[model samples]
Target: MHTSEHSIMVNGIPIQEDDIEYASRSLKAASHPLRLKIMCLLSQHEMTVQDIVDHVGTSQSNVSQHLAIMRDKGLLSSHRVANRVYYCLAESRRALLQACSSLR
Candidate 1:
């Protein structure tokens, strides 16, 4: 990463306004313990809401709410198959997640 008079480079890529906003949102979304746990779980593999509830030991509604929040923040993405929804971390935010994990 390098810095210019007006721009910052990240891994040889120039950082832009949208990139800054996205990183900030992703960090905020993963700041919560439950949400961070969810990210850790999903980092391993995509999981259904029931699976997340079981792993997080939280109520389904609570897990669903967190999932929705993360999805809205673009830190997570979901797809439906049949009656179940599966979620995984967005590829763009995986590096942020790795940084968060190292802080643990």
Candidate 2:
């Protein structure tokens, strides 16, 4: 069978409709300006909440709020190292970001 005719498997099962639902939500979350800035910052390297707030010229709580929304929508992820929380894009979205950045 052609590659297009074959199904890709995830976690020993085929991908489902719910995955598409999450992608739709993630696309919407990624459309915001501050969220884009956060993506750009993390593209360079993962960063802490304070780093994002400082660079984006927004309040820490505001940054956290945005981060939380992005996290919920499946556009980004966080890793905790001791007291610091580092955030980065979902591994799959990096190419999307590179494409978006190329427009500049």
Candidate 3:
């Protein structure tokens, strides 16, 4: 008996259509300049909302909104400690961020 397996491929690499939608969301989440800046900062270390506001030189409310978007996109993870919440790039997204940073 002979059997064969076939898979959809892109650039010689197998890929799923669903992956494109997910990638698009991540890319769109990082498209904003503020979000990109936040990603760069978070890439170094996790930070509280206030720490992000201080480093990014933006209003807390604006920073919070952007953080929410990134968080929703699965690009970032958050940890709550005491009265503060810290945010950082999700482990899986870190390499994607590194590739993005290199583009600049």
Candidate 1 vs 3: which has more TM-score: 1
Q: List the candidates' TM-scores in order.
A: 0.89, 0.77, 0.86
What is the descending TM-score order?
1, 3, 2
On lDDT, who's better, 2 or 3?
A: 3
Please report the candidate that would top TM-score against the real structure: 1
Global local distance difference test of model 1: 0.89
The candidate maximizing lDDT is: 3
- Residues 1-104 of candidate 2: C-alpha lDDT, one tens digit per residue: 33634765767787656776776787789899999989988888889999888899989999999999988877788999999999988888887688888895
lDDT of 1 at 11: 86
Q: What do the candidate models score in CA lDDT, each in turn?
A: 0.89, 0.86, 0.90
Candidate 2 matches the true fold with a TM-score of 0.77
Residue-by-residue lDDT tens digits, candidate 3, 1-104 = 32235556768887666887898889999899999899999999999999999999999999999999999999899999998999998898897888876874
Model 1 residue runs over 4 Å out of place are 1-4
What does candidate 3 score on TM? 0.86
Model 3 Cα shift for residue 77 (angstroms): 0.4
